[model samples]
Target: MTTSAPEPVAHGVGRVRVPMPPGTGLPFSNAYLIDDGDGRVHVVDPGSPTAEARAVLEAAIGDTEVGSIVITHLHADHAGGAAALRARTGAPVLLHERERDALGRIAIGVVPPDLEAWGVPEDRRPELLAAAVVPTAPAATLADQVVEGALGDAQLLDIPGRRVRVIGTPGHTDGHLCLHDEEADLLFTGDHILPTVNSGLGLGGPTDTNPIADYLASLDRAAELDTGTLRALPGHEDPFTGVRERCAALAAHHLRRTEEVAASSGATVWEVASTLTWTGGWDALAGFTLLSALRQTAQHRELVSRRRGL
Candidate 1:
């Protein structure tokens, strides 16, 4: 039996959302193929489902060889197919060095347990934790330093006829990176800014610092870019216009969530999560909802600490 291929949306230099069936109850996460119309193709964030995603990717490439695979972060929905795609295409997988160790921890099954302490009911924790484990390996690492094989803040990649700039927009994940094509006025945003929903920014640890602060800074940075007729090819949504507006909306939404958590007065992350009305049903979105609450709590704490100089 032959399955139909995932539909591809043509953007400036390539296509996005090479499909695999939607799983984990979320809408389809996008997989982007960036080619200069040459035989060389760079696939970004090849989304989940090892076998089916690979088949769709192979179909997308047709006879063209995959030049490289660049991961925006270590999230399962984004990087789950890296190893499989690497083996199939004989292509090196690239990830930011800061995230390399985290990916290793994920591969070795060392990620911290879900924040059950915050009040997620016992019955729901297992599935959410299981889903988080799938993506965490790097075949190759993008170096740390800006010079000497490292990606600079807005450095243009040396791809012939393709002007892709690497923009370091950390926060959703510490090592998250977005690609901006100045010539195309397009941004391949991986979970930094989505069209419909605010991306979750979980707290890694106490000393790990406030991700919301970083996320806000990243939003500010994104706003400063030349966004004329901007089209954002996000990790989960269709390529849409109004990149800055969406970023502002997400920032405002998170700020409001943080305020609400703060006003709740000593409420735990799970308590805040349970109180709020999320878009999707709890059973379907329990995983993300709980994480979002944790993130909001962390942001609230950060705001309080700043007020007292603690």
Candidate 2:
């Protein structure tokens, strides 16, 4: 439940659904507060970068000391308010070492998708390229959000009475993570396995390994947890049970997508993406939407090729 005062989300976690920029296709981001039972609270996923969003968080924090700022990933919505919060409270922001490295890469700017390589028609190229510069969240600037510490796989938080372990579940991004509270049986799954939507793969910078393969393995790894009782608190949606079922469903969806890509007739990424199903039909995709679709199609095709050893 969304609340200004600290409310129990599970055994020790409190939640605040921080707002996002308009037309972002998402209404709010879940900012979890884990109290250390020692007057300090650890903040996770600080939500969109805005003075309004920061006001909400600062009010929720209310007189309590900030123990640390932990980021699950490097998305603007999740890591946006981090800079301001750290500037205000001097809380050392902690992220996975992989994610920290990714931030360094992002600050230098990432390469845009090769439209010609994807075989996009010359007419559609300008619009797609122009959309790249329009800021989706003008208030949420990511270039300034820096990391002061690195979190490793299975690394425990320094809270005296908690046993929260950071699980490196890289799929949605190159350095995505999920926090598993062994004592409380709660997993703070940050876009790794959402209750409502299937997160895209390899949205981060260029990776040497195949994203589909990495995502599939990550799904299996998350399924290893106790699915019957462990509740997941996602970055967007509300908390839920049935971890195993959710993991299986996500995996099946990806596998089926790979099979569809394998069967589709196409000599290029654009051609195959056109034949695939989209929420508003393939012709409706443009700009960032089109870019994302082509990238995902390319990843699926790579997965099929790897499995066949081609």
Candidate 3:
């Protein structure tokens, strides 16, 4: 009873959205095809490889060469098809150095025990411990340093005639990045500032140094950008404007959720998430949503502790 994949819709400047198959747990992660006006096409976040998505990619590019594949982060849904796409198109895959390490952890199913070891409280240890056992790994390794090193703030990525500035937006994932086209004022927000829902701030492993704080700061950084005619193409949902508003809404949502968690003196992460009022259904989306809630709680606790000098 597999659902069909959504059709790819062509956008201006040779960009197209190849939607992944539905009911795959991941709701529509888009594979963007950015034509460089030359014969080369730059694909961002090929998403999980599926027969349908591959077909869409082939159709979009046609005879145009796939210059390179750039990954937003190492999340499986985003980077799963990197290896396959590269192999298919003979295109070199690029990623942040930190993301390469994160990809390695995903490959081995090693969830870093840092969250529990560092800031997670003793009473909440049981639930955190259970979550730590869950494994989410990448399918393959991205061999080369696509963008050299960490793209701090912004770095120009020149592909044929198209130039995209790589902006480091690290709240969703430690090494998460977004592609900004200064000429077009378009930002390829890889799960950073989404249109529908805010990106999740996942556990960065057991050794993460205040990830929630880092994420909040990252959001602020994104909000500070002087964007004009701002159009953001997110990993999920349609492209839209108001990037700053979306980031602020996400921050506020987490802040309120954190306050709620704090108000419940004895509430565990699971309890808090279960009791929380969310927009989407709680069945198939539970794993991702719950992880987001837990990460939010973790960030909230850390912020409170810092304020109190705990």
TM-score of each: 0.80, 0.92, 0.79
After aligning candidate 3 to the native by TM-score, how far in Å is the CA of 129 from where it should be? Answer: 8.6
Backbone clashes under 3 angstroms, per model? 0, 0, 7
Clashing pairs in 1: none
Which stretches of model 2 miss by more than 4 angstroms?
A: 1-3, 130-147
Best lDDT among the predictions, by candidate number: 2
lDDT of each residue in 66-92, candidate 2, tens digit only: 888888887778887888888888888
**Candidate 1 similarity to native, TM-score:** 0.80
What C-alpha lDDT values do all the predictions have? 0.65, 0.81, 0.65
1 or 2: which has the higher lDDT? 2
Instruction: Write model 1 residue lDDT over 122-149, tens digit each, in one string.
Output: 7867755754433332322222211123
Best TM-score goes to which candidate? 2
Which residue runs does candidate 3 get wrong by more than 4 Å?
A: 1-12, 24-27, 104-109, 112-135, 143-153, 203-207, 226-228, 271-275, 280-285
**Candidate 1 vs 2: which has more TM-score:** 2
Model 3, range 1-310, lDDT digits (tens) per residue? 2333334433334444655557545556777777676667788888776676666656656666788788888766677677777777788777665566665555566553454434445665565556553324452455342434444456677576666888877666777888877677778888888787666676333325566676778788777764645788888888788888888888888787667656665444554445555667433334434455666665776666676698
